[model samples]
Target: MATGDNLTTTAYIQHHLQNLTFGLHPENGWSFATSAEQATEMGFWAIHVDTMAWSIGLGILFLWVFRMAAKTATTGVPSGLQNFVEMMVEFVDNSVRETFHGKSKLIAPLSLTIFCWIFLMNLMDLVPVDFLPMLAQKIGALFGADPSHVYFKVVPTTDVNATLGMSLSVFALIIFYSIREKGFSGFVAELTLHPFNASNPFVQALLIPVNFLLEAVTLLAKPVSLALRLFGNLYAGELIFILIAMVGLWQLPLHFAWATFHILIITLQAFIFMMLTIVYLSMASEKH
Candidate 1:
């Protein structure tokens, strides 16, 4: 079966990977891309409209669903949605309780949000890859844009920017928690004196810079690793789906097989992201 755009296999995969971008056009001022070359040139200045749209939309949807579940929760017999929500809540609460040493009213809720929001974003990969983009093409036609140029990638977690944005947010929380739990002086001391101790004044002074550099790298690695791990996994999964689609009708069986196994990968990645976040925050909240 031919794709809606009737692109060759390579072009189809490239098109699927392209984000629906909007950016400053030299000729058109702020405008959406009318060509892949233009979108590529937009580069760092361009915003991935599709990724942002789906990410924010899914986040809102997650909050709304949980809010509704909480609002309608009953003491007696719980409905299926309520039961599912409670199960997720209890799971996140237990995970945080087990991992987080310090008390914060925010950890459990944060964990819940991370798990659900990321899982929902990752869930987009399981959609038939061409369906949403095909819809986007139709929408582009209404705007008098060339339908073939209207690229839309629906999986937010597959985008590095989205992953890094979330990781950076977690990094900010870690910093805030570190400052709140340890005073400014203590936090600075940890950076300069940790993982190395010297009794002599001159030796301690000499080690401060070394310790700071090492610790800074370690601290920075958290967000970098978190971002890359999630992005790599989901992006690879999405790429596999796109590749499988290139095989024409033979893609159906492979698609089903890969997607079935990918469900585990998706859930595990979400859980790992949530758990690492909790652990990192817990470490920050500690005095040592």
Candidate 2:
């Protein structure tokens, strides 16, 4: 348990917010932080160990469940798990078909993974605020670690690094698709010619820099928007939950109400992320 000296509300909130960070400590080499000050000293090389663990764990869970459903799938009728999995698969397939203009074997599965994995991550926010952290503290004590300093954050989507990591992966796929659909020279020309074109040689040559600048910004903005929008909404929602929990016994009603409303936000954000990814890739695959 935390000492009474560390029992202030600000300390409580900050403790919940801090990640279980691990990295090369400035003085101690590679290690986990025993305190927030130690975490900050680890600098840019630090990784949010809890965030990576939860996110990757949830992702593996998704794949295992879907794989099991597929393995047991029946032709005539379906089990409840199979039925639900089929419905989700059909929904993702339809969404990808509606949005993506070009053909690729990867889009349907990628969209499904993004939607389901993100939805799972967002669902972690619905867990009771202090339950896992408390459990983690108990476990830490068993391992001879300081329970007060051991921290674990459950929701991965609320972390900016996690969101940006997923978005940047999508950005890489966009570049790959663009290059595959259009040759290297064609890709460069698309970045330096369209939206403003000229037949005259001199005028066309002069427009290269202008077109490249505009197109570059537009391309970069897709991933930036994807990352920030998700991180912003989920972070704000998590913060609100933390604030409500500060009310003690009065928090129950408010917590239930916010969690109910937040279901829509979570589902809509996942859909938007999947759809925008499809749209961006579609745009990249286009000739014009």
> Which residue pairs clash in candidate 2?
none
* Regions of model 1 farther than 4 Å from truth: 1-6
Per-residue lDDT of model 2, residues 135-172, tens digit only: 88899899999888888889999888999999999999
Residue pairs in collision within model 1: none
lDDT of 1 by residue, 52-167 (tens): 99999999999999999999999989999999999999999999999997879998999999999999999999998988998888888998989888889999999999999999
Give candidate 1's whole-model lDDT: 0.92
Location of the lowest summed lDDT over 10 successive residues in candidate 1: 1-10
**What TM-score, to 2 decimals, does candidate 2 have?**
0.94
Q: Which regions in candidate 2 have their CA more than 4 angstroms from the true location?
A: 1-5
Question: What's the residue-level lDDT of 173 in candidate 2?
Answer: 94
lDDT over C-alpha atoms for residue 64 of model 1: 98
Instruction: Estimate the Cα RMSD of every predicted model relative to the unseen true structure.
Output: 1.5, 1.8
